[model samples]
Target: MPASGQTAERNSHLKAVGFLIGGISSFQIGATVAKGLFPLFGPTGMVGLRVGLAALILLAIWRPTRSGITVQSLKLLLPYGASMAVMNFCFYVALTRLPLGIVVALEFTGPLTLALAGSRRWLDLCWALFVVLGLYLLLRPETMAAGTMHSFDLFGVAAALLSGCGWIVYILTGTRIGRMFDAGHATTLGMTTAGVLLLPWLIPVIPTAIMHPWQGGMAISVAVLSSAVPYILDMLAMRRLSPRDLGILLSMEPMLGAISGLILLHEALSVARWIGVLCIVIASAGNVLTRQKAIAH
Candidate 1:
């Protein structure tokens, strides 16, 4: 490529990296905001509002059409949408009882597992070991028994595990959908489907919950910050950057979530837990870098 072309490409790559960072930051901040509203809306109500409003906003913005969709596409989208709904619902439920950082770390296992499953490289195995060690440290029995331990809910942990399973489904299905439709169109449709799936649970609480204007504002904020902005940014970044680069950027999410939880909600991790989080971050970055190197070879 010519000098000018090379310079333009470098600039585009930097722009994508910036978008990815901004998107993840927005997501973590939105999560913190949602946690603060737990007393008013509860997990189910909050998930409902987040997904429902997000669907509306994306649909409005994207205005996706079904004109070119096939029966097979619809089949794929149905499960994809359901996965998204279950993932969000279970994640929020876990958040009600767990710290935001812990929940995010646990949820990340799904993608990490998927990455491991697809690679046989010895270096990948090493990264897997690091992840396992990190998880063990994060969830060790001694830590829970310590005087500093917050009340831990076993059910919340289980919900987080289930959310991880749902996340695996989301990742696999989303990859397929990305090939079939424009990002905005696919996301809009999938989100609408998720909102529809959650309606039965959401309808019951709407009548009894005391809805305040400030709460409504917060809900909209969550939709914008968490769903709309992140998805759009990811889409833009994907256009300019390799998936390997995107994966590396995304691996920082757990650390960011931990910091955001501490700053916004005053949820602090123990020293041991912080070490575990650092391990996971290192493992994730290592895995992505190793994969990229392997692909180049």
Candidate 2:
């Protein structure tokens, strides 16, 4: 390639990276904001608020028509949205009890595993070991002063893992949906469907949250920063980058969550716990890089 072409390509890649980083930062900040509202709406209620408002925003922006709607489309869209609903619920549930960074680190294992699946590379084994070490570090009992012991809530840990499973389902179904429909239309409908699915549980929560206009504004903010902006930026970045690059970029979320929590929520992690998060980050990034390498060979 010529010098000018190389420079343009480098600039393009840099722009996409910036988009991905901004999306992740927005998402972490949104998570911190949601955490602050737990006293008002609670976890499930907050998830309802976030998804409901996000659905509306997405619908407004995409303006997706029902011209091509069919039962066949609903088939994939339903499961995709269901996965998102479950994932969001579980994630919030876990977040209520665990540190934001820990919840994110656990939830990230799903994509790490998904990326590592069907790989035969030796380096992939090392990534798996990194995951194991990370998990151990995250879960192991750390002793505190004054005869205290520090540990994560088992139920919260379980919820985070379950959230990971939901993410796996979301990725699998989302890929299929993207292939079958317009990405914007599919995302708009998927988010809306997720909101509808959550309504069964959020019936009371939604009405209660709506009564206070102030709470409604907060919910809208969460929706815009967390769901709408991140999703839009992700779509844009994904178009310009490969899946592996996307995966690598996403591995930074645990750190982002940790930093956001410390700054906005005043949540802090122990030194070992920080290392545990780093291990997971490395594993997540390594898994993606190895997958790319395997594909090349």
User: In model 1, which range of ten residues has the least summed lDDT?
Assistant: 142-151
Off by over 4 Å in 2: none
lDDT of 1 by residue, 1-297 (tens): 999999999999999999999999999988888888788888898899899989999999999876979999999999999999999999999999888888888888888888888676889889999899888877875535556645457898888878988999998999999899988888898999999999976676565443587887898899899999998888788899998898898889889888988999899898878887877888888999988888899
If scored against the real structure, what TM-score would every candidate get?
0.93, 0.94
Candidate 2 has an lDDT of 0.88
Candidate 1 versus truth, CA RMSD in Å, comes to 2.1
lDDT of 2 by residue, 1-297 (tens): 999999998999888999999999989989988988888889988998899889989888889887888888789888899999989999999998999989999999887888788878889889989888989988998888877887889999999999999999999999888887888998889999999999866677777776888987887899899998898888778878888898888899988888888888888898888898999999988878877887799
Candidate 1 at 274: error in angstroms?
Answer: 1.0
Candidate 1 pairs with clashing backbones? none
Q: Pairing residues by index, what is the TM-score of model 1?
A: 0.93
Best prediction by TM-score: 2
